[model samples]
Target: MAGFRWWFMAVLVVACWMKGVAGQARQQQAPAIWVFGDSLVESGNNNFLRSTARADFYPYGSDYYRGPTGRFSNARTFSDILGDWLGIAAPPPFSDPTAAGNRIMGGVNYASAAGGILDETGQHYGDRYSLNQQVVNFETTLSQLRTMMNPESLNQLLSNSIVVMVFGSNDYINNYLMPNIYATSRTYTPTAFANLLLNRYSRQIEALYSQGLRKFFLPGIGPLGCIPNQLATGQAPPGRCADSVNQMLGPFNEGLRGLVGQFNGGSHPGATFVYGNTYGVFGDILNNPGRYGFTVRDKACCGFGQGQITCVPLETPCFNHDQYVFWDAFHPTQAANGVLAQRAYSGTTNDCFPMNVQQLAQVRPM
Candidate 1:
């Protein structure tokens, strides 16, 4: 009987060990989220840069649990909310000191405030990382990952990961629109400028694809015309948005949708490109604010001079942030971001073209 008891104990130990090994394998194989974008998804990367566009102050993160973590929103950004829905922890910014070694296997966010698709788009801001630079940083992450994971495992991890990219707004806001500061407006018409951006953006996407990234979620720029910054211009009729600015964005959004279709139509093997209809979603909210539980859509929850300026450091913001759509002159409040992230994660064709993030997450690599 004593001999039998010893054998049973040995069997139990081996079984427990096998269970732990399986759990570890599953954890390693879990899909991670790699984020790359501009201010809308900045996450705190700009804190590490010597940029004037930094947001590491109070009122910026008043509603966030960590309080002023460099996020441009009052709480979580769009990518942060989306990551919550996916059950994936938001990755540390690529520039963070701790984002190295084994910690990188979880993922990395390369988003920077004032960033844009074109390198020169937001140069006036000082020290912003362009989309090209973000991609380069991603390559560096891939290199470090290669040291820890075999080529096959690394490729598998990357191919299964979801990449979120939000850009192009700054190209219009900071570059083309500011004709005195940038020659792009003088050099090209709105259509031509859109084409130029799409061309550059296409190259960036292809570059990422070449690096084994297969699942991409690209959220199109929202209605900049409706933001407090543009509305304060007095360029529109009373109770209306800056229609001229909104018109200029149409071609860009259309071209972006075309790019998604092109990518999925055999431009890149095993690639699943999903386009989030940010314009449509935000427009719907603007047109029907009450439907989305928002009371103020035309103004910002926090502003300084001219109602277009961003929230001043340590300045007090509106108490009812959830009722307000715009957080500052440009970004959305956490409440609005939650709605946008929810729709992008699971909404139908009207929200995200082809498939939503939830659907894209389930698709196996071709």
Candidate 2:
């Protein structure tokens, strides 16, 4: 009887793996979602690289995918969430230009961990990729896609698809915050620096629009002032956020919001911009963590006192995941991401909850 039970359990596991998840097989006719931007969307591209921003190690994927796929988080991310919502597999790695074509059945996550829009040098963050490289890789991926499908099919794919872009964390955190070896080390007021960033960001968005991408979901900065590492190192009153850091993010988000509105309300409507109020959602979580059923809202779960040391499982494992908002000093936990995803994909920008998954899907192509 014991042996029979063991065989039965094995069969059940195999069946789950074989079956389509989130209605993937049922929604075979839906269009693909093209993901772009930074580490927030990184499903596992860093595993192939020799970078420190890698999650291929243990405890990262132990929660969701069950094993290491090199994700830089404790479990599945927004990219994976989008896949589940779309009933298809998440996007493939940017390293493999042919990956998008291979996954032809689902969306593609072109986001690389540590990538940014304005910084093309790839030196801002160690072990992190650049935004330009992601776009370049995407061009190759698109060419491969063109080869795999008929002209009509390709056109349909582009027209019916959605593009999600989320970035700017590294630009502020790595380049502007701490002067890396490559920088000239100039001091400019936060306003000046933000203007510079916005200018560069505008150019990148324009470039994407020219590429026939008509549906855009651009997420603004989250609570940058609340991250454990930043708060621990930065000068702020006890229980108070670093107002200066959060201040800079507003201008950047404002510029993006204006651009989104321009495209959405313009005469030559080539793309529909869907604004993702990351700031609002993250702020809500921070101000009232109990609303989300979180216990430790101020400090990270894995890090040392006030989040100074390694927050990895071996170094210091968290006791209760759902009770904590942040998984590490830098990133949010899986449950937090799940809540964020639900908010991002559920309604119109005017909705009290901000943009949601359904609203993002409703973005009509140019």
Per-candidate Cα lDDT values, in order, are 0.90, 0.69
Which runs of model 1 end up more than 4 angstroms from their true locations? Answer: 1-30
TM-score of 1: 0.91
Clashing pairs in 2: 91-108, 91-109, 344-356, 345-356, 345-357, 345-358, 346-356, 346-357
Candidate 2: tens digits of C-alpha lDDT, residues 88-108 = 567677664456445743556
Error of 1 at 344 (Å): 0.4
lDDT at 167, model 2? 81
Our tally of clashes for model 1 stands at 0
List candidate 2 stretches off by more than 4 Å: 1-30, 96-101, 120-127, 180-187, 308-310, 348-356
TM-score of each: 0.91, 0.85
- Assess candidate 2 and give its lDDT: 0.69
Error of 1 at 335 (Å): 0.5
Q: Model 1: which residue pairs collide?
A: none
